[model samples]
Target: MDDMIAGGCQCGAIRYSLAGPLPPAYACHCGECKKQSASAFSMSIPLDYDQLQVEGTPISFTTTAFSGRAKHNFFCANCGTRLWHSGSIPPDSITLKVGSLDDSSGIAPQGHLWVSKKQAGIKLDQAIEQFDTQPDDVTEWRGNLGQNS
Candidate 1:
């Protein structure tokens, strides 16, 4: 069994607990990510959807991703803090914005994605792998996984 990670929105109105090790975290430099975060990039941890449980309802806004997939951005309706994002990947897995976590010190991004959209003056360490676009290998693997079966 994996340890549980507890977190919530800034206002504590939306609480969530994620069990098991989070999937490899990624720093996304896509335009939409930057726009939403108002930063150079957005860090996220992808976890099985069923493994995530929220205490309150989160507002969702659907938008087209760079891949042309319909991505839903979920946030605490009260505070409007972006909490998680869901897309066409697997219903069992959704990406949680790292910023939403109460304790983010344990989470470190393993790599950077959508490097092509990265902003200037944002220097990334050489230790992590950088991809110009979404990693095809991860997509294939996620697509093949059965949803909470």
Candidate 2:
């Protein structure tokens, strides 16, 4: 794919490239995101499974999320750096962590999800759309972003 974007894990154990022009991103403030990222929130760009091309063997951990969906997190086996995650909530789509990008300047989060669960002292952008919980439809969420922003 032309204009492909590429990135790797901290230790360069896991590398991946995605086709150009990924979907808009969002920040998740849910507890799972916080714990998984070791931060106040996690940001990711949703991409079709077919758009991702990976070059390393990553270990995976599957856990039931608060939404009752099974979330699969993949990480570099050598350095334990998280690569990406997929969940039943988004079926057939993979959420690529913005943090893993070689150049994250191209990625911009357009909204925030699970804001109700956002931790104390964690600030959010009031300018972007905010959802108290995960929206049932990602398209609806994106639509709201377009309409509101």
Q: Could you report the Cα RMSD, in angstroms, for every candidate shown?
A: 4.8, 3.0
lDDT of candidates 1 onward, in order: 0.78, 0.79
- Quick one: how many clashes does candidate 1 have? 1
Q: What TM-score do all the candidates reach, one by one?
A: 0.84, 0.85
CA shift of 29, model 2, Å: 0.7
For model 1, residues 1-149, the per-residue Cα lDDT tens digits are 25888888889999998776666677889888999998999998776678887798888889998767888888888888998888844444588888987777877677788899999988887777778887777565434333322
> For each predicted model, how many residue pairs clash, with residues at least 3 apart or on different chains?
1, 0
Point to the candidate with the largest TM-score.
Answer: 2
Q: Where in model 2 is the C-alpha error above 4 Å? A: 88-91, 138-148
Cα deviation at 78, candidate 2, in Å, is 0.8
- Which portions of model 1 miss their true places by more than 4 Å? 88-91, 141-149
lDDT of 2 at 91: 36
